[model samples]
Target chain A: MEQGLSNALNVLIVGMATVFMILWLVVIIGNLIIRVTNKYWTDEDLKKSAPKSNHPSASKGAVAAIIAAVEIVTNGRGKVTKITKQ
Target chain B: MDIFSKLFEMTAFGIVTYKTVIMWAIAFLLLFLGIKKKYEPLLLVPIGFGVLLANFPGADMGIVAAENIELPDGHYKNLFEIAHDYGILNYLYYALIKTGFLPPIIFMGVGALTDFGPMLRNLKLAFFGAAAQIGIFSVLIVSMLLGFTINEAASLGIIGGADGPTAIYTTIILAPHLLGPIAIAAYSYMALVPVIIPLVANLLMTKKEFKINMKQMDKLYPPKHQIKNIKTVKIVFPIVLGTVVAIFVPSSVPLLGMLLFGNLVKEIGSSTSRLAEAANGPIMNTATIFLGLSVGATMTSEVFLSPKTLGIVVGGFIAFAISIAGGIVAVKVYNLFAKKKINPLVGATGLSAVPMASRVANEVALKHDSNNHILQYCMASNISGVIGSAVAAGVLISLIGG
Candidate 1:
């Protein structure tokens, strides 16, 4: 029972870690897209290209990096290379 | 003084402490191999150091007893007297390693972090995992016939699967005596996958088989809907499998249960993060430290320095050879009826070293044709190998450990 509960706890951490990462990514990429494309297009066009969840247009890299770090801890060097290549 | 001098002359090298000297030499060799040559240094280095501490004849409590301490690494209760309170096996292995809990936990983090879409897309790779079991049994039968007790044979047989935990788990059940060599052999061979698999792959496959063109797989990011579905399957698959295996063979409950539980935790996706953390975090770290050290402690002179150890070492090689051959040949046979033919090298991934074996298959496939990408297809074989080896270990434990 302890083992099961411990495992369940780990799953939560992994899920949150993954969400935090994805959220951060959406934010950063959103910002970059808005800033980069604002010069070429308009704010209305940007909204059409990007979906608006709670994640704003900032801190994408931070989340992306954290997710990558957690993955590296769990999976090791092998998958990191495999994912980057993909 | 004259009697002491006479005793010194009677030793192996006419030295009073020849045995201690010999142990120290062995220790130096392990350290050198681990540090200089980089052969399984991560494990061997620590193991080598432990060996040094173990064999140092005067590590005994002799100095404190003031009996005129003369040697090193030998059993002198005066210096290292505390060791007596904890026999090497009890303090190290039974207390830590033999609880049968750590390796499967690691597998959970593996499942969570792992992407199974590759195997899902190509279900045929399961055959390769099945193929690897052939090696396990072949080694088992041979080892038993060769005069090893059933447990030893089972432990030796696991080497073919090229999995460390399964081997360690099997040894703990079947032949705890041989755990030291068996675990070391399994992990050593795993770290040598890049070296060993290629040699075996080169020997087993014909130029034609090696050169075959594998299909291209799509590399689309998993869509949101599909990802959710996979999450459900992953969680359910474990509980169902664990119940079946646990019911059939309670002996395998610790290993099979832990593995599936890890997988389920991974599958649940949102229940709790501690499951993954255990597999990925403190549990793994603590187990690794204790496991490696205990394994090292078990390698005292009496057990490790025997001719039978040679057989255990040889058994590991045989297991690897049989497993790799089983995997490659199974792929070729499966292709005869199937609409699709995969690179035969992927069969080798059935040994279940996780992404490493599968990645090696990808490398071999790429060698034949740069454009070919068989990794996704091969991954099924790899994961199946994981399940296959675990079940195989369970079977051996039931048949033997029971």
Candidate 2:
């Protein structure tokens, strides 16, 4: 029983330390990956690669009106990507 | 009279005992919970049915321990002979589960189904997932003090992970005898995430803490950087993280490696969509069926009707409660120093129950203030809990099983 208790204590210390160490590394590396990717891969690049709508682009008046509505509704947090007729 | 005696001997009723009847009642309870309550039905139904089959008299359907199988020649029966004598369930239990093969395959499917976007967006919250794992190790010490062997204690402690595959995998390595009880405890508590999360949260958190609006906090203290190309980042993430984790804890590679591989296929889009679909669909479903049945088959009348099983049930519940409270406390501590406060519900969600724990936390937050939506933030910690638990399992396996 003494041996078992000691071993359990060892596991408790080693297990928690290892788990925290590994997961902390994951957080740091994850942040680094995000920063490096964002630095090299700009939003403009994403926009360029984005698939074009099969239908033609909406008229300037319709596009402006839709953008205005979205801006109001989302308080400038939303962006218009595609406009299609129902 | 002679013919009547012979016929009676042929019937199962002649051999059925009170133990067998008790096991059947237990099986029926599981089935009722699965079919009626709809609590993790996909797994519980098969497991319940398997338990019933295992306990049936005269069927010999229960999984037999290797040493228990002897032949007339005084030599142990080989795999073929064991299959011939026992049943297919025994064969599967030995081949798939004893070898620790199925759980990682199920994990691969889980990975394909996961989206790590929320976690990546809120990187700081991932620490709570690690904090929540305090329950697993804490339980290990308590179980040992309660007279369980170190191996058995490790198996019992993993229930705190709240991940069925991780628990089963650890049990298979450290203490195969405890697999049945450990698997049942893990899954049952996972299904009870809705009940358990709220219970723990209410005990640990205040109303104001629950009403902390994550959206307002985000606006006031915005993230320093934005993921401009999320697709590329998602694809690269699993690879980098997998490599780093494998280096630190090589024992985790089997489960974590396959998980990252599945996620990679899913994130790669059209090229590997077929692989992802196959992984999350047919492959995962088949593994769940076999896993549930084989695990349940291990729960024979002789094995499961022990005082130890009762300890596992109680210990597993305490593990869940402690893990939940750990997460909530971590968030509260973080709030003390940080200007941007996190709702304690986000911390309470640091369990590996996937969307269920996150959803429960979201509901609790919404109850306090309807507009305080924190599902995405909760997910950030919840997903990290999955990784944290898997890593913790690996550490236990390496330290004890090795």
Candidate 3:
């Protein structure tokens, strides 16, 4: 039982350390790759080609239009309580 | 002699055993779950039917025969003469599964289907994926204490990842005998994520926590400024990450290589769309069917009824639960330092069931507050769980696999 506990503790430390190390590296390198790509090859066409529906601007734009309609209907008296995307 | 006696001797009824009856009932239960409950129908239906075929009296549709010999490349070479060697499912199992060829191809399909944008957008959430894998090692210890050898323990531990293919891959390498239970447990828990995650999360988190809105992430980074060249980043990520991972753990290269290869095909656009279609469509479907059938057929009564099989089933659930908790705990730890609080529910999605885990997180979030949409954040951890599991499997293989 003691031996098993020892082994489990060893695995807990080493296994977790390795996993965090690998993922930490992934996070760093992943960010670095994006930064480098953004710096060196900012292709406007490719950037435009990327889908934009999930972006804040897209959601905000939809909200702005709704707010404009609401303000007109209420003669600028009503205020937007909340704006959230489903 | 008597004609009736002769006919009876040749019939399946004569050969049927109690074990066959039990296995058939089990198969029917799986079919019920797949059809009625809609629990992973894509896999369970085929697997359930395969179980029926395998348990049929006098059918000999088992994926393995007593006379089959394993070859160097993991193919089962039938040496019991051609007359007895022509089991169709056995051929499929040996040709595809026994050679260890199917899982990587499945990963390729998964790669083609996945979008890395969510993970890229929220890199911090990626660590939650790794954190969830604590269940793997934790389970490994428990399994070892229960008398499983290191290899068997490793195979069983991977169920924590919630990634079926990685679980299957690790099992095939470390403990082929436990493949049936391990695969069943992995996929079963994956299907039950909608039920399981909420159960675990509700226990760990308060209603306020579940309702904690992360829509503010949109304001924090503003999706437009997140990444301008997502295409280039997506294309570069797999290549660079795959190389780094392979250099660190060469045993993982096969699965990671095919995964990255498929992703490259997808990201390259129209020129490679045909290849991507093949990888994610017919080829992927074919692999899934064969994988399901072979894995199901491999679970004959003698192999399936063991005490260890039951242990694997129990251990797998524990592993999965622990992984979910691990991710949540990691988020709590991360919250100690960070200004913005991440919904710990997103951490629960660190398991690699992909969109299912993320969707469940979203649903649970909606239950507390309707407008909350953490699906995008959940996806970051969800996708990272795949890579984390694959790497964990590699590490286990290096440390314990024979």
Candidate 4:
């Protein structure tokens, strides 16, 4: 009985850990790639009218929600520092 | 031979001895619900077939009786023994079925089909979705009060999350013996979302209260970094949950783990597209078929004919309705606190109907005030519900199975 109980515990731990590890790698790498792409894609000055990169309501350096969420979680709450337009 | 004797023999052969026909009728009902009502046909099809197989006698009965196989050359060994000797998969069906692996893959398909875009626009919906899952606890408490074991209560309560995979995942870990009843009940309620949710939603809100106008949260397409954050969230979310679960219930880790892995595959950008395909295509599709049938295989008359199975069915409906009520109540609370007129109707979408529930909320909102576009808000809640229920399921399993 003790062995059975321990076996169940083992199954649970190993399974959940695998999921966690996989997610950590995927999310960390995926976010980095997205951040890099965003840096290149941003149009600092509305040089091309078509490049409506600057958010209509947000500040010049405002990130997307997905990015903002990641930054806030990883870099800490204060690190996010949303730069809303004055 | 007496004529009565012949009739009795036929009756024994067909009616009492072979209960497959009645079970098949139930399977047909599932088919009707899937095809006609369009209630989660992906799972219902497989689940219905499983019922047919499970009810049919002689499935595993012969094998159950035989401890070993005897060969003419004086060799006798168990199925597992032979499998070890021959390198074959022993009771592979049970491995996937009893362990609850396949259902979570079905969830991956569900996750892939989900679009969190609307959810991003109005993140407040997450709170509402989270609130709806409160039913898991309430039901858990009730089940425990009713003298069920801790694991049984937890497994029973997860049905309130309204996510079949989470319910199955939780059950497989906490109470493997109750898998048949719990799974059947959970899937049945999930498929009946259209009917069950409306019943609960109406009970909570009147026509006037249900159709409040909520402000449209501004659309901000996620920046690249934000997209990555979401992916990171997708990744960490599962792991954090798994870790927490491991420390607690531990039995449910496998179901949670596989589910998270599938989600991780989707978030990993390099393989995102392929991961998306696997979640939606062959792996998910095939698993649904096998999982449902294999689960059905467990529902033999001897086990299913009991009052406990009936309790699972009743408990499942109660759990689902309570969660729906929880969502409605949470929305009302949010409205009172935020003082921003938000539709209580949108909260029902937190039952994880994906776009369908959101669309239903949109339709309801349109009926009241055409200008109010609450469907998007509802969609955010819908996606959040997916995550909310999954985590809640894990927690419930830990508490109960521990």
Candidate 5:
């Protein structure tokens, strides 16, 4: 029983420490990977790879308001072209 | 009258004992839970049927140890002898489960299915997953005090990981005899995540804490680091993380390595999508069926009806409760120093039950304030819990499994 308890104690201390150490290493390395990759990797492929957005189009009221504001600011000189949601 | 007596001896009714009857009831209960309550029906149904098959009188369907097979030469049976004598269930149990093959394959499937986006977005929250593993070691000590051998206690303690594969894999290494009870405990508690998470959260957290809005905290203190190309990061993460973990705890490589490999294939897109699909679909499903049946076959009336099984049931529950509370407390401690307060529900989800734990935490958060959806944040810790528990299992196996 004494030997068993001692072994159990050893496992408790070492198991938790190792778990935390390895997982923390994962977190640190994971973050570093992100930073290094971002720094070196070009985003030229991003536009092509990016999925088409399925977001709903802006309402008529919102479009009218934007056009009205533009008309007011430019004193009827600005023309309304195509509008797309970012 | 003599012919009738001889015929009666050929039937199971002649040999059935109360133990067989009791095992039947237990099997029925598991089937009821799986079929009616829908508690992990995919696994429980097969396992329940396997249990019933093992307990059937005159069938000899239960898994038998090599040493247990009596021979005139007084030597253990080889695989051929066991296969020839004891049949298919025993053969599969020895070949698949005892060899420790299926759990990691299922983990590979789990990895292919996982999305590590939320965890990468909130890296600091991953620490809570490590903190939640306190339950495993703590239960190890307690089970020893309760008079279990160190190996048996380690197997029991792994049930706290709340991951069936991890528990079974560790048990196969540390104490194969305890595999049946440990697997059942792990899966049963996992199915009870909805009930268990709320129970632990309600006890440890305040209403104000429950209402802590994660989105509000994010708005107040915006994150600085952002992944410029998420696709590239996803593809690179499993490789880097797998290397680091394998270096530190080589024992974890078998399980974690396969997991990372599966994730890599999935992230690689069109080139490896077929591999990912095969892994997560057919390969994983096949492993699950064999794993479930073999594990259930180990639970014969003689193995499972022991007093030790009762201890496992009770100890498994305490381990689960402690793991949940450990996560919640870690979040509370983090809140004390940081400007951004996290809901304890996020911490409570630091178990390896996957989306279920995260969903439960999300519901608790929503109940307090309908707009407060912390599912993504909860997933940060939930996914980490999978890695954490697997690492913990590796540590235990390395330190004592020899």
Candidate 6:
């Protein structure tokens, strides 16, 4: 009984530790892959217009309402060639 | 030979033993559980029917190998005679089961149906799945103290994993003699998780803990920005994980490899739709029937009636209970440091009963608070439990079998 108890203890520790180890590695690697992929591959349209600046309400960042104004002045046909942050 | 004598000889009463009658009763109970109770009917109905067929006096449907056949060198004239003597079920047992083929195929099907997005999203929550394996080790100790051999105890211990394929695979490798009872016990307790997990959770945790709504936990810590283009990571994960596991514990490769391969087929998107459908449908269902029946057929009067079988059944239940507690305990520990508190009940879902365990967790949380939609969160641990059990089985096979 004592020997079995000791062996069982070994299994408990080792088994738990191994599971954690493998999964922890997976977690770390998974995060790394996601991080790397996202870093290199932000979408082109999202990059073209700053999400923070483009919202009509504009409570936070500097507004680029100039893009809408440009479209209106062009009779809804013109693309805003460029906008510089002031 | 009188006509009456021939009639008497053909009757079941003529060859029935007390043990045979007891086996029949057990078979009937399994049938009731499967058909009437609707408990794991896919497996239980077949197993129950197998038990019934095997118990019939003159059917010769039992999975016994041929007896008293001696082989002397290459010139084997009696090979056909030996083949004729073998039971029909024994052929299935040797072909699909004895070589350890069916369980891995079943895992492939399971993998095809699995979605790893949840586990990948919350990697920290996944460790609770590992913690749930504490039940397997605890039962291993008890079984050993009760005089089971180390291999036999290892087989008994894995029943706590709550993943039928893992339990079946481990038992077939370590202690094939105990496979029938272990498989039955594993599946039976899995069906009982709705009752068992809540009892353990209620005992260990307070009512407030059960009501910890993770969906509302964004108040504690702001949710992280969701990552984009996750498909690339999903495709790569199973292959990388499978490689690492196989490299570390080669014995686990067959089961884990097939599982990851199946997932790969599913996630690769549109290219392998036919293969994926076949793997998760017909292949899986066929394997389940053969596997269930062969496992049931192994439970002859002598084997299933033994005291050790009782110990295995009891030990399996304890292992399952302890596993639930272990997951809950791990979640409590995780809650201590994390900025956002998880519903500790999610921990109880960290056994590999898949959507069933996750559904039970969701149901329990909904009972406490209707708006607590933590199914996705609970699924993280549930899927992790599958991999965790496979790894634990591998460790046991390596440590003890070595």
Can you give the lDDT of residue B291 in candidate 5?
Answer: 89
Model 4 achieves a DockQ score of 0.06
Candidate 3 DockQ score? 0.24
Candidate 2 chain B has its poorest 10 consecutive residues by lDDT at B64-73
> lDDT score, residue B159, model 6?
89
Most TM-score-accurate candidate:
2
Per-residue accuracy of model 6 over B24-85 as CA lDDT, tens digit each? 99889988999999989999888888888778888777766323333465343243553476
True contacts kept of each: 0.00, 0.76, 0.56, 0.03, 0.69, 0.51
Instruction: List the candidates ranked by DockQ, beginning with the highest.
Output: 2, 5, 3, 6, 4, 1
Please write out the lDDT profile of model 2 over residues A41-67, one tens digit for every residue.
866786574434435765556665776
* Residue-level lDDT tens digits of model 2 in B180-253: 88888998999999999999998888878888999999999999988887888899999999999999999998
lDDT to native, each model: 0.63, 0.88, 0.84, 0.62, 0.88, 0.83
TM-score for candidate 4, please give it.
Answer: 0.69
Q: What is the TM-score of chain B alone in each candidate?
A: 0.81, 0.97, 0.94, 0.79, 0.97, 0.95
Residue pairs with colliding backbones in model 2 are none
What's the best-to-worst order under TM-score?
Answer: 2, 5, 3, 6, 1, 4
Q: Per-model TM-score of chain A alone?
A: 0.45, 0.57, 0.49, 0.39, 0.51, 0.46
Candidate 5, residues B1-402: lDDT per residue as tens digits? 999988899888888999999998988988899999999888888788888888998899898754566567986666787788898888888888987899899999999999988998998889889889989999999998898888888899988888999999999999888888788888899999999999999999999999999999999998878888777888999998998888889998878888889899988865677789899999999999998888888889999999999999999999999999999999999999999899989999888999999999999889999999999999999999999999988998998896
RMSD of each predicted structure: 13.3, 5.6, 8.8, 10.6, 8.0, 8.4
Q: What is the lDDT of residue B3 in candidate 2?
A: 98
> Residue B278 lDDT in model 3?
95
For each candidate in turn, the TM-score is: 0.70, 0.92, 0.87, 0.69, 0.91, 0.87
Docking class of 2: acceptable
Find the 10 residues in a row with the least total lDDT in model 5 chain B.
B63-72
Which structure is stronger by TM-score: 3 or 5?
Answer: 5
Note the residue pairs that clash in candidate 3. none
lDDT of 2 at B189: 96
What candidate 6 gets wrong by more than 4 Å, as runs, is: A1-5, A41-86, B65-83, B223-225
